[model samples]
Target: MTEHPSLNKKQKQLEPFIRDTFNQEMSSNEGIKIADDENSLKAGDRGPTLIEDFFAREKLAHFDRERIPERVVHARGYGAHGEFELYKSLSEVTMADFLQDPAKKTPLFVRFSQVIGSRGCNETVRDVRGFSIKFYTDEGNFDLVAINIPVFFIQDAIKFPDLIHSVKSEPDNEYPQGQTAHDTFWDFMGSNPETTHMALWIMSDRAIPKSFRTMEGFGVHTFRFVNKEGISHFVKFHVKPLLGVHTLIWDEAQKLGEDADFHRRDLWTNIEMGNYPEYEFAVQIIREDQEFIFDFDILDPTKLWPEEIVPLQKIGKITLNRNVDNAFSETEQSALHPGNIVRGIDFSNDPLLQGRLFSYSDTQKARVGVNYQQIPINRPVCPVFNNQRDGASRYVIDRGKVSYHNNILADNTPSEVPVKDGGFVTYPSTVQGMKERKTAPLFKDHYSQARMFWNSMSAVEREHIIGAFGFELGSCLSSAVRQQMVNRLARVSRELAEPVAKKVGVTVPEVEESTVTRSTPAVSLMNTIFVADTLKIGVFLADGFPGHEVESILKQWKDAKLHPVIVSNNLGEVSGTGGVKLKVEQSFLTGSPLKYDGVYLVGGTGADDYFHNQARKFIGVVYTHFKPIGARKECISLLEDMDINGKPGVVIEEDAQFGRKFTEVMAKQRFWERPSYLYYV
Candidate 1:
């Protein structure tokens, strides 16, 4: 199939605005070309700088105010251009144009971020990830403001500020910039037990995703989807990665945090390399009449519908194939709002969802100005009609004399259309309840689902969760806070709490344990899809390496669609024994074992003592992390010395077809059955 010029229709529209500054003379904000930019006007060469240098003054003034106020949450973000193709028509459940036609494709922009971190924070920090996407449908723009995790720390949006405040670094000290492993966070968790479920999620491998393309996304709140017949169903949005849901183990995540922007860099590089990320868009739907059937409240923000109970209906596929031209102009300026819905999608009575409708609108006004939606990235493909006038950064120009409704001059042009003509219409949901600041009684039972989450984990995921809790609670100086967390964990599961209690040096008090022992296996990461395509493999080689072996490995790697990175003692070409030379992509000092999914140790004779020792050091790290290791010829000596040769994920072969076997092991991701293990370097 011939590929389109741009990733989507929306990107094609943005092409004209992309500046061709390379071949053109430099110009000011206006069209006037600049003669010189080296110096400001002055009385003489050494005289005081003059104030009359308009070009210089304009440049400096713009630079001074280049930054906009970063988001209070989800500040550190990266975006991509994509198109969503409908795989199946969801017309039975929704009248949304994008969801109605299988042949139609909707252009979209997705911005992934680390919530609760500043703009400069590392992407690998253990935290909830933001996965907001803006879909440009002909009817209007639909923003699916979602998160990687299905649940949240709080049930109500009113407590959102408190949740962010407590999870952030302490006010007086402002230390520990990117993590929630602190006293204040635990204290808040202890006081508000509603946070127990989400705390477990953040402590699990889900918090540290392997890549943005491998992570799952969820619309945290229950919404309403109305069919053409005006029949409504409570809905939850889900995105399953075609590459499979995966994560960085704690050890790799910690090391990557030091490098920072690891995940951001991965997303950018993959798109640029034409390895576009794809995910299937699905939804869990519950009829309005069956809302009361669930044991938990449907409107609760911190709960999820088990996939087994409410099966997901796959509707479409979203493929991100283009990287942004400018980060700030395309990514930072983009605004997403849950309220930006089409006629088919409507808000539910979910309290968190209700408050977010107001909060997001207000935040955009304060952060990006009232005209934020008019910004190119946020603008809808359809015509925007409104009676409102200008504000800061307003790009639209209304030429009509009258800008208000009920006007005779413009004859009330841009009049609203009826529902039959694809006009907006709210689901006439009848409301009869007291206006009070309270939630339903069912929202109080936070432990049952938390326990279900614990019971659902596979053995490996369970151990990681326990280690996460131990590390997080152990960092807290307050024993009381640690004990409080242990007690809360006991309510979820005794197996989860006991080990954490011992690690944190706390006595786990016995809380009423949840009787819910049933597990939802679908939620576990152990059941995710495993493949070798696009996996980054680090290749270790030195001079005098066998050319045939290296050449053979590269061929299999290319066949498996794996990224082979050459790691040696230094950069530049290294000669093979068969007169075959290879370029070193990264040295040991620059390329750490944590960066690649697997490694290949090809034997080399002409290496320094330091290089030999570094080879062994790299093997130990990879072995400890349970990553797949492929050893050929002389490199087998390095693995043999470690006594981990022929391990579960270690493939050592002196015979032919070594690369084929190694490629198979890389697809499994990690070998958890290795003899004895200790997490962290």
Candidate 2:
């Protein structure tokens, strides 16, 4: 057990209130049983619901009223409840209870979202993912409303509305739902020029994450950490997955969107199987006096503090160990804001963050209700007692007269707490600036970092980014939009812009130099982490010849902590060598290999030619992506006909060398070493 910073006077008082409120909301309300909330009430004959169903009505009403207004952006989302366990204290940097004490486990709720989609939109679309976490600590609820992408499209908050409006469904037809492949988006990027870095990110594999568990999360804004002595330091937050960052190919992502529910199913199934996702909370700290050391403005959300300059400090681990009991009640109703912070954590003058501080709570009130914080999922676990009363769905029972301050009634009950004992005191940074709005000169340079990102990508990652750009531009009916985007790309790198232009059948734009010349190499996907643990491999087999072989391979896989599912043509006992049998987890006709991290073929007597053919097709796909492939002697013979021998990640044995070879090959994961430049459809 590690010691975390203890709750001060206020948090200790408020803790019971939040806990009690959570209990009250979870309890039976008006004879409505929420225990069995997963299912809906049906008639005895299973024909229709009974009219006298008050419980059904309550559930439906709750569902219907559940959708407060979807966020103008980042509307489609999924959330989970978890705990953040600190690995070490950061008392030197800040006095935040959650950060200073390694022993305290703070319960947190996290929401992962698609920036351009609606509440019911697809998950795998090529868009920035919202990775927001709200820590319900004893001090207060500290919300880090962040994104998977490390940077923003624009530097200034004033341009935020414009950026969103351009990428959203067009005002005229409202067509191109949940996509940026259109005129306005390209036109904005072309004109702004500053969006080049983020545009590269949007084009990269980072936009199409394989899962929320596999993607990296970033605060995307410079903040401040204040200690007991009122000293401030610039800071950035990062959430690196222990499993490492991973993404699906553009082609796979599109197929995934053919069923928009793909991510939801993947998450739910994995959690049900006890594959809990974990992420390490890290921070990039910079002393306040050293903010000027970087070429780019530290406060610019569009730019990143290169990791080489400030390496990430791993402070804690956050595990999504439990799934939401009800999606609508918890995931949907939950609200997150960057403004929520504890005593030690404080905000910087980042314009984007300032805008978000105003936007989140305001939008929540409009979407949920006037008293949105009173919503069970949104409410803090800490106690909230004040003169604030009488709003829509306001459940608090203020005991006694005088709800206002400084009145004789109720003897000034719920009086203000002093700051010395424990009260939120905003870091008193001096603020004096002209009222007129203008973007700082430091925010202007954007193409250099964009070029750095493009230059740093691996060959495969670069190709996907180019392909993504082409695919998106090709979807645009407007020739002008495509030309404008091509022109914008030329400023970043002509090498990048030319291929995309040719593929879209447009002439490459002329090289136009931008004012910005500084590049930060740290902002590239090529530099992200990768590991094989938890990688799912679909093993397609029938009544197999070698049951022990399958079990042996499975044992090794278990040792490696890799997930191997024995799939078959049908769900039943799949007999192996010497009549040993393994239960089929899924059938090929029912599930696709695209869901798996890899695939293994095990031949047996029960497998018909049709089954072989089906397995062949899926195996071909797994091989095309250079994913791990495994087979025994008979299985090797089967793959040889398809010319799969000698391919990278292909494991085969002439006799019984299968288990050892397959395990070694699978451990390496995808073969980026594969020389095949050919793109397999």
Candidate 3:
């Protein structure tokens, strides 16, 4: 077999399982050649097939049983092959092989998904995103199942089902497929004060990310990392995108209704175009002795360790470079579990994490079959040896008569190894507690962190949060649920509660607000990294355009790693001055302003009224979204016609530095300081 530059140990291992029929004739699953398949061995033309025909029966049976049960949540997902390179050794905190070598590149697969939607739901909905990564390390497969939100709705995993059911479509009517703007969701929130912190987070712009590449991922539950000396330290995992955390405004996100696969398409297209997504893997480590130093419970999944207090230590980087060859085979069938840890990593006493350790394995068995681990995508790159046999879809065949441990027949072959010999040994920590359903005292103080989240937001982010609350609550038909939620919010902050209460026609009650005045600036998107690399820009063009200036600006944008696609009235070659023709990638009807990061208006001298009107409409949407806009000096009149010239992010091509200035503006992603009335107009 030929070697590929991108091939890693896991990719090479998958080679033997990858079936190729590119130049082969049609054959049955049993390897028999088939002369006719389309007719299906019918009695006559368009006649019913007979059961006597084995080929027809086999084909129909496989087709009928092809689909497996969809996941209870995170049904819609996209995955890619990647490698994780450790930045430095962490031998002091963990004995995991993947974290021990800085030069080694561990092969991995990452799946990004929406948490609340079905397989057919819109990808741009305001919801939590799952960012699970399966690291095919030397020790074993380590699955880091994470979400874009650092915290969860409930502190314990026992309430996971209740949380999901409430946010899903109402049981009676089944209305509102992929949204939380309904009565049932608010009703649950009003009843359970434990969900307050996560509710505030989802209401913010983080729920509506611009792209999966710009989202932050977190392992919500605190875990333990054991060193070679058997010392344990609390650890929290994080994945920060190198491009920075960016989000789509509510209006812009709603306008993406026509493109249901917006996020999925963006991820696939960028990876295919060689613009691989990159993220830094970091961890927040807390000594075991310092676990109870915080006001909130360290084991609580609903609370986040403030980055200011516990700084993140960057350890590695992940780069997703290859898209999956078959979505169903690799992405859909792949199983990830937080319990799939290596020898160095151990579970914490976090209630949610403990419950998930059991739930994920059970669900995988039910959904993918008992022998799901034998599936190529979920198989470990390391050698497998076990005395156990399988049931359905079993791929491995044990050659010996002994299927049990300590068997005299085979002299106890496949014997377990000791801890010193590379066997997994769980951390021997003391455990002494009475079995009870009650939670810790600190877990009951849910409003403190919620208030801290509210205090951390910038003015624009706070406004967006208010707008989101208004939309969600206004859609609810129940006044009592809305009032209860407002009262709960008042406990967090009256500044947040009063506006939302007024908007939803509910009165805020007299309640003492949270005394926590502290804020974590790292939680806010206003302080995120900004870079123009790989940001898509739509270049509006037409016939009789200035070829030289357009070509120069395009080259400069490309040099700065910006993706520019030509958008005109129609597809095909668009003529410019001096017979310079550029190929139009998309027409006005085919491409929407919501699809691009920014717009470049270069209205042509020979353009028709339709082109101008479409350009105006496109720029209007871009301006309203507060996205950066660039226009040629000749098209200043066009911007004036739309009454949007001299806007905060508008960059006119009146000087040689226009391209650089425009690129700089696009790097900022959005101009939140734009007049609020423009958004409504």
Q: Best-fitting candidate, measured by lDDT?
A: 3
TM-score of 1: 0.98
| Candidate 2's TM-score | 0.89
Give the runs in model 1 whose Cα sits over 4 Å from its true position. Answer: 1-7
Tell me the tens digit of each residue's lDDT in model 3 across 236-307. Answer: 999999999999989978878789989889989999999999999999999999988888889998899999
Structure candidate 1, residue pairs in collision: none
- Positional deviation of residue 626's Cα in model 3 after best superposition, in angstroms: 0.2
What would the per-residue lDDT of candidate 2 be over residues 1-681, giving only the tens digit for each residue? 322355433233334444235545443457444666555567665668777666667767877854456778888888877789999889888989788889888888888889886777787888999899989888778999989989998877778889989999889998678878788888888778879889999998888888888878999998899998889999999999877777887767877766787777777777777888899999999997897887788888888877877888999999886677677767777888899989989999988888888988888888777887876777777788887788888867777777788876667767777777678899998889889788888888877677767766777777888888888888878888888888888888777888999888788756775444444555555555666677788988877457776787788777777888888888887888876878888888777867878888776887898789888988877776678887766777668888978777887655456555666676566687764444422
RMSD of 3: 1.3
Q: Candidate 2 — which residues are off by over 4 angstroms?
A: 1-67, 408-411, 513-522, 654-661, 673-681
Could you give candidate 1's per-residue lDDT for residues 22-73 as a string of tens digits?
A: 8788888986889888978888999988898889889999999999999988
Runs with alpha carbons beyond 4 Å of true place in candidate 3: 44-48
Better candidate number, 1 or 2, judged by TM-score: 1
